[model samples]
Target: NFATLPIVAIIGLTIATMGALTSLPMFWPLPTALLSASVAAGGLALINSIGQMAGFLSPYLVGWIKDQTGSTTLALYALAALTIVGSLVALRVSRSSAVKVAGPA
Candidate 1:
């Protein structure tokens, strides 16, 4: 599961590097001064870490719910709905509200 982290980092870095180089402008401070290659690399690493943790935990949590419910199909469906709602909230709503919906962490 954790293996994906390295892969994501590699891929994200490669893409970001190519993008930066292609868009790189000849200037005193550089074109995209606000976002240097190092910062982009760090952001990619952060994303990879968070994604790996979520990927590892999501299935385990869903399986545990199924075991407790004694029905895998129902559990998956419930989880799907929850996932959709969660994604919507996470992407659009205030994080405070999302945390409230997510409950005490």
Candidate 2:
């Protein structure tokens, strides 16, 4: 299922639009829009890449822990801890990095 195109598209679209991204036209205020779009794109890519890496690594980490300690609970706890950390980081980021664009609105 890793090579599923529709699933990948859905995930990509969700990540991209999760930040309220939009295509910018090439014109006057369009320049500002383009800049905003680029920033959004970069942020989305960074977040998605990190998320994907974590998703890919988690199972491997769990397997390794299970192999060594013969217990999956520790790995699960580690995953939960990571999730909490990520959530806290996201909350701080959302509060600190609010972007404002002034053109007509």
Q: 1-105, model 1: which lDDT tens digit per residue?
A: 212588886887687578646532422222123335556566556646976887788788878877898766666576668656755654453333221123376
- Model number with the top lDDT: 2
List candidate 1 segments past 4 Å from native: 1-38, 85-105
lDDT per model, in order?
Answer: 0.57, 0.63
Worst 10 residues of 2 by lDDT: 23-32
lDDT of 2 by residue, 16-85 (tens): 5654333212112422333466676675566569769987998999999889888877886787688668
* 9 Cα displacement, candidate 1 (Å): 33
